[model samples]
Target chain A: MMIPLESFHLAEPVLAYLDPGTGSIILQAVVGIVLGAVFAIRMFWSRICMTVSGIFGKGGMEKDGEDETEHSG
Target chain B: MRRSTPAERRLPSSFRDPSGFLFQRDGTLFRQVNEVYREDFQRLMRPDGLYDRLVSDRLLVRHEEAPKEFVDPELGFTVIAPERVPFISYPYEWSFSQLKDAALLTLQIQRLAMEHDMSLKDCSAYNIQFLEGRPVLIDTLSLERYEEGKPWVAYRQFCQHFLAPLALMSYQDVRLSQLLRVYIDGVPLDLASKLLPSRTKWKFSLLTHLHLHAGSQKRHADDAATGKSAKARDAKISKFRLTALVDNLQSTVRKLEWKPAGTEWGDYYADTNYDDQSMAKKQELVARLAAKAKPQSVWDLGANNGHFSRIAAEAAGVAAVAFDIDPVAVEKNYRQIQSDQRKDILPLVLDLTNPSPSLGWHHRERDSLAERGPADLVMGLALIHHLAISNNLPFDHLARFFHDVGKSVILEFVPKSDSQVRKLLATREDIFPDYHEEGFEASFGQWFEIEERISIEGSERTLYFLRRKD
Candidate 1:
């Protein structure tokens, strides 16, 4: 509910600063540095995977759909 | 230094930011810049600055520097009088698309701030308010001079305020946005992390920002500058990395969508008890009443998709707030407002049984619904039965409520004979013995002077227009 800012130990707890929730700041740094590279790599890999899947996935699409043997009927 | 009189009241929410605080002097709102933030204030107000760009683009609420006399020499750098927003609706009140649009607006402002050699120091959702049917940043002091290698102070806020709630609403339920009322700062990341389904773990953005980021907050929550904490505290982020982070957030926000479907109120107008002819007649009557009232502002209670509120606002050429119980209904109304570029009506999610109360420090930070009202007209088109019969609210209480929020009231009285009222009575015992036409008039007569009453042509319903008795 209503969390008192003091309950969460902020880096600047000693001062009268609007505690930017220390954990959030650190995570931002971590995500900014690490996730950026991971995301870029993931994007490039996904593109390649999509290209490969685009060719093979058509067969899977046909398998998933109901059989359309209208000419035989 | 002149002492701040009773008339010169500082806003409670304004005390959080050290740069500036908003205060009202003689009924006019003004943001006073502290001496400490003089440089940052100068940078923000400079020629071709972020303020000019944002105001020009209608992304930010416009303001003007107040006269010299308004300044408090002891603690003030300057004072700015901002253009007032007609209605102050919260994030909890917004629909999925409304919240999403506000999110995108925040991100856009952030990027623009960076481009202008500044950064949004505080990304609280409260900073954004809808003006003229568009979300605009109301807080002028949210931005500060950009420092190299400094991580965004408001990233956690942006996630908690905008990203977390948006994700939960999209993945789980639209009602999840209401969690903002309980958690004031935004939905707690850990709570959001717990509430969100496991399937969200596979979504790259949600995984990194919400789940992993939540873990990071929990990990460093109590830790000081020791090993992992030290590394986190002293971490340096490149501009490129920051840009990438913003890009990720932008893409994530842009991708999230809620189609406003499957709710009971989705097709309310079509499935209502009224047939085409009766509905048309009701609309014509409402338009006539609105014109007759000559309202500058109207409040439509239980306005499902704002059917009648739109008529009232359009016919009177006035602004109106359409409040409804279901988020879906409000969302549909909001989407229509966006598509039509309608500027007169603001649709919000509101349960009349327990409307939004006064909130924050001494309950003064956000004004309650009643505090924002006494609207020129309050139209309760086809809603009295639901309150009196379904909710078991007394007619006197309803009358007082109507009188409190509105100067004049236009109420539609749905009789026991009405099919809709019969449907309500069919499910439960009809305990409302005094729920009749004369009973309604007598009860409301205590607070209002009955001016006119017109019965609908095809329906067993009467529309009464009454002016509040002083």
Candidate 2:
């Protein structure tokens, strides 16, 4: 499981002054933990899940719903 | 605090970021890096550093270290001169695509910063500028060294500044982009959440980043109000997670698209009243006037896909701003600029009746259009009737506005006999009895000297070139 930022510790202090917002920090921390755990599980268990699901006649790993886009031509 | 020398004047918008402030000395802009920003500034300026990489990728503005004498002896750590954009445009003034592109650019920079072991200290729409038809980050001091287990500091600002406005524009009315003018720090997420359609909540990205995000802000409002920084500050989001967060935002911005169609003036020229001879003649007349005017900059008020502004742009090495009321028309102009690879023209969405005003702290954070220019020339073709007849504006009001924003104007006066004017009057009673050529000359002549007047060959419309009176 990914560590939530609230409980995560940093050795260095951030130099910027703008508030990152208390709610935003907590929400993103939750999101980050979920996404990281999902990616980790997918990476580690892809083959096992794919084979097991295939044997059961179910769908395997779905494609990552991401496409690359360029900023400047 | 180090005092500005007699020659150095600090720009108002430059005061927010404390790493440095942009000031002008002898009309040339320079960023004065404070002593506290020495390490980050050095890292950026070092060879093969983040600055070099970003500049090479055209993600950020390139700058040169100013002469030693240019640096202030007191508070200035050092000074660097950044390359100037032809024109600076605000997020409120941007087209849907332009704003979307800027959002993507900010995310792109953030991802790249992660790879470089740095983070954007702030994410603001004002920091991004449209340069040569592309959005580039102009603030060189925005990057800070990324600390392990530290969350992205600009996440809230990013959502507010880009995602909120974009979502409202796409899911609601495009004119809702005007909300950027009211909320200068980007649209409030709670407000955005309320205004957005219920259908948008079905979208996973919007649901998390916007709806839930606003809810989170509410949940933590009291904590923030009580100054409970210890709890949030101690919370550490790992670098990997932050990277994932940025990646998701990038995908979200990409998926949010606004197609330019169905707007009133999007396809305006397709069914214009001007026939081939009259259109060509009008073009010739504008070209002749522009050539004689020889302005370095032009503002094409009511510029429809920039057909007339192109004359002035081609005649002189001019930086032209094309202002139109229709978002689709401005989008078409922007897309054309991209496809054509033209750099001189900037297309923006603006309502002439309610132009952008002074905003932010002291009403100086963002400039009004008139404050930004007194453009060398203003080309207002086939636009008088809309302002005069449709909007019920008087000739003197039009003249004074033009005088305030430009040194000269190329105005076209369409007679009441014109079909477009007749169509406008058909809906309402013709209360504008003074809407005649003689009255136009008389009211405008109070502020401007009529330099030239030519009637189109095939139509009854008259074109006048007037220079502002000294």
Candidate 3:
């Protein structure tokens, strides 16, 4: 038999969220923060490396940029 | 107080869904859709086209609308009669590949639902059942119209039920799948995270879904208990992002693979003492006995790789459930069924000594192995000695247990002198003085009437066909 939401004190009328327990909510928050940071760092790391390399070799960097844009296009 | 008939009985496990619940009437199973789910149900059946596509694709069990008179009209919007599965199996009873396939099926159903502007309300592994040799979703009311900018609510459940256990089985040990039995809602993310190897954190999917997921759950739980508001953490995810999440999960599940090889029972046939002639003779005896009984369903106990269960299914035209204790053997058997598209045999991992038990709400939501059966026939080939000697189960107890689960039993008695029995006895004392053929018959004769007994030509083992005495 299916358990009723009222029994778990989770019946919020017309609300979209199905309360996934306090533990689950907390866990998702922590996980989101860590994953969000990782994603941010990875995305910026590539751009930062490209900028640093461009400072060292302007002509080579320009050629690489054209190749990248061509591949992306 | 009034006596409730079996037909009026509502399945306890089905009550979790306010949308609908399964009940039986006149020996037929029916689902009662509640009024609270009327709008979603209408959408599923009408403009959404979710029900039609799923039923046609054979991804969901087909159902027919039943008269309202079939159930209490006040509580039900409508009643539907779904095609009954021959046998119901749980996730814990499933082999690694079986669980993986079920997970993939759930994701595929979700993807399909999105195309119809619907989404699955929940992703419980119990909603999927192996029918016609493949996993099919049985919960008709689990689909609901999708709302934009809402996160996939069932994300944590899917990870807990499917991803966590799959990761543990793939990374830690295949036997860890037993944790599903203890954690009915799926393995606790925190526990699974701790049990998993540190190296798993390097894998992006594992890190995000399990390791980070576990940490978030713990922190949220602690904060909430302290009366702290964590509403800011509830991020609004676009439909595109949700679809991408589903795709990522599919890739993660697909990449997690387990090769069934090098296990003890997986290589049983190669090391068996029985020669080709004896093995063929044994198969013939089992097939002939199964044909004589003409059973509608058969359970092959300790069916290593289902070598003999196939004989019963093919020879008797009966649906067979092949059960073995070893995951590798069951994996190989399931792989064979998938490859051949065989519909008659279902291979599951089961340890007869500690079989699947009744669990969930008041221990009634799910059925125990014994509750699911009394199969028409049970084949126990070369398995008696293991229970008798290795596990210290007596013949009388084994006979009674078999009689309780089957009307007819086809068993093989391996003498103490047999190589396999000898190997079992090698590790322990020969305290079983009544382990001989005569002792075996006397004990089993209490519950079953012996019909036929045949000795293999080249082996010291004997096969008996017996019918339970009414």
Provide the TM-score of chain A alone for each candidate, in the order shown. 0.40, 0.42, 0.40
Clashing pairs in 1: none
- Model 3 lDDT at residue B60: 94
TM agreement with the true structure for every prediction: 0.88, 0.91, 0.87
lDDT of 1 by residue, A1-73 (tens): 8874433633331221456666877778777877679657766776666667687775332222122111000
Mind giving the per-residue lDDT tens digits that candidate 3 earns over B342-387? 8898999999999988998899989998999899999999899999
TM-score of 3: 0.87
DockQ of 3: 0.11
lDDT score, candidate 1, position B273? 72
Question: Model 2: DockQ against the native?
Answer: 0.39
Span of 10 residues, lowest total lDDT, candidate 3 chain A: A64-73
lDDT of 3 at B125: 95
Error of 3 at B130 (Å): 0.6
Query: Per-candidate interface C-alpha RMSD?
Result: 11.6, 2.3, 8.9
Per-candidate DockQ values are 0.20, 0.39, 0.11
Residue-level lDDT of model 1, residues B1-470, one tens digit each, is 46678889877777777777888888999888888677667778878888899899898999988874554667777888999988889988888888888888888888888887788887888999888888889998888777667777788889999999999999998999889887888888999999999999998889989998899888887777555655565666877688778878887888887765554433545567777898899899899889888887899999998989989998999888999998878887887888788888898898899888888888887778998888999999889999998899989999999999999889999999999899889989878989998889999999999998888887788999899999
Off by over 4 Å in 1: A1-17, A38-73, B1-3, B70-72, B225-231, B260-268
